[model samples]
Target: MHVLTMLLPVFLAFALMLCKLFNSLRTMEVQMGMGVVLLRYESPSLFWFVIAFQCLVIGALLAIIYCAFFILSNQVMS
Candidate 1:
């Protein structure tokens, strides 16, 4: 029980971080138009996209690793 109590908070924290990361990256648009005028800007090309994608992948991988370790520790403690 004590093991779970400690590990749960860490899991929640990771879940929140992943949620925020995804929310922030969810809105990557190049153009927004209302009909009166068209506004567009190049935030980043394929290069930037690739970079961001890599970061996301790495972040998720690290989170998974952390989760795995947390579970292992919890099991070992019991």
Candidate 2:
């Protein structure tokens, strides 16, 4: 019971972060679709910027997931 109380907020926060990350990815997908439509008219630099931003987001997402799993594993082992 005590462990449950301590871990509940962590679980909630993890879920919330995952939800926000997914929402951002969805938004980025929509933007990318629009970007494709405008690619011919847009500057090359703008397209590269979008690609860089996406890579950064994906890297961060991977790192967050790794950390979450590490923490959960540690919790379970202990």
Candidate 3:
């Protein structure tokens, strides 16, 4: 329940995709017409506000990973 609340606004699409994929793998009864997928969530403001910060954090992490991989690859070649 808490996870649903937290992910409702920001990761709603991802969560729904996961749900659909999981449902297809088995008969979880979560299958419904695509039109019925409503995302009427509370605290939308919280998700909107956090989106930018989350993007920055993810970007920073990716940058670090890229740098680390580049350095390691250079070392391997030398």
Candidate 4:
């Protein structure tokens, strides 16, 4: 019971961090779009789309890695 109380908060914090990371990356993509439109003077939307899509893919990979890290670490600790 005591172990769970301590670990629960840790797990929640880790989860929140992952969520925030992804959200910030998404916001970055939006900002990049605005920058391209206002500064580049090019119809490079497809390029931005690909870049943002890569970010999305990378985000998923990071999430998977983060979860796996936590799980393995918790297993080792126990």
Candidate 5:
């Protein structure tokens, strides 16, 4: 029970990350179908911005997971 309590945050963070990734991919697919290629050529900055945002989101998720693990380990050790 204690272990599960400690892991709950980690699990939630992972689920959140997966949801974000799936949502982003679906949005991109829809945008592409609607002619994002034209926008890509017209404004390369938008393309790069999207890529950077995705990276930032993933990085933040990873940091959350790391923090959860660190806290869990500390609790277990103590």
Candidate 6:
């Protein structure tokens, strides 16, 4: 459980970094489907915001889980 607390954030950070790096490549090819062009891309600021939000949410969840477990375990001991 404690290992997860450290790994979760690291994994999120690495995922975000990889996404940014891939987006930087700017390798979007035009796709024509049913006479409609489809293009998918991400802006740097949007990417950054996503990463930041993910970190925030994950951090909060971990804190909450930690607190709940700690309290429950202590109560059991008492």
The top-ranked prediction according to lDDT is 5
Per-residue lDDT of 10 in model 1: 61
- Stronger candidate by lDDT (3 vs 6): 6
Best by TM-score: 5
* Clashing residue pair totals per candidate (backbone < 3 A): 0, 0, 0, 0, 0, 0
Q: Tell me which residue pairs clash in candidate 5.
A: none
Model 5 C-alpha lDDT per residue in residues 1-78, reported as the tens digit of each score:
574586687678767766655665555521434554424455677765765676677688677667766765687553
For model 4, how does the per-residue alpha-carbon lDDT over 1-78 read when each residue is reduced to its tens digit?
454564565566557655644554555432344454222224356546655665676566556567656765587553
Off by over 4 Å in 1: 29-78
CA lDDT scores, all candidates in order: 0.54, 0.55, 0.46, 0.53, 0.62, 0.53
Off by over 4 Å in 6: 1-42, 75-78
Give lDDT tens digits, candidate 3, residues 7-72.
345455545555554543354232236754322144445433444444565556555556555664
User: In model 1, how large is the Cα lDDT of residue 13?
Assistant: 61
What tens digits encode model 1's per-residue C-alpha lDDT throughout 1-78? 554576676667667656544544564432222643211234456535644664676577666667667666677543
| Superposition-based RMSD of candidate 4 using all C-alpha atoms, in angstroms | 7.5
**Relative to the unseen true structure, what is the C-alpha lDDT of residue 59 in candidate 1, on a scale of 0 to 100?**
77
lDDT score of residue 37 within candidate 6 = 31
Residue 16 displacement in candidate 6 (angstroms): 15
lDDT per residue (tens digit) for residues 1-72 in model 6:
564574576567656655543553354422233764334453455545554664676566656557655665
- Backbone clash pairs for candidate 3 read none
RMSD of each: 7.8, 7.4, 13.9, 7.5, 5.6, 8.5
Scored against the true structure, residue 38 in model 1 reaches a CA lDDT of 18
Residue range with the least summed lDDT across 10 consecutive positions in model 4: 34-43
